[model samples]
Target: MVKNQPCIEIFEIFTAKRLHWVVKDKGESWTGQYFRDIILTERVFPFLKNEENVIDPDEVIFINDKAPCMRAY
Candidate 1:
């Protein structure tokens, strides 16, 4: 951001049926403990558990994919 405005950062997850979004103030590092403790345990799991989502927690799977540009060349 320029001197007058704030910067924004976001993280997200999705499937054909739904989308989840996380917004954080700029420069917040998503360390492992923070990710496991807050993001998944507090946020995502709850979202998935919501009755409207009709999710079976046992069947959910997560995958992390690097951007093509970040892959070995």
Candidate 2:
């Protein structure tokens, strides 16, 4: 018998009147390295860099909810 049910992590970003969705791959979990390397580096940073998404990249702020992966380190 399985002790745990299957699940995936997903989140959404708010851009003024726009909404952007981000979902992790199936069977994968969010880890500190993955968060630093992939999510922040590959995905989030690029999105923030785009002028269409942000007017001033440096002025953008992040408010962490103290996620497990973030505290994992």
- For model 1, how does the per-residue alpha-carbon lDDT over 1-73 read when each residue is reduced to its tens digit? 4685765656687754688887753566678787767766777777666545535544565654553321111
Runs of candidate 2 with Cα error greater than 4 angstroms are: 1-3, 67-73
Local distance difference test values of all predictions, in order: 0.61, 0.62
Clashes of 2: 0
Residues 1-73 of candidate 2 have per-residue lDDT tens digits of 7778776677556655355666776766688787777777677666765667866665665544664322111
Report lDDT (Cα) of residue 62, candidate 2: 55
Question: What TM-score does each of the candidates earn?
Answer: 0.60, 0.66
TM-score between model 1 and native: 0.60
Best candidate according to TM-score: 2
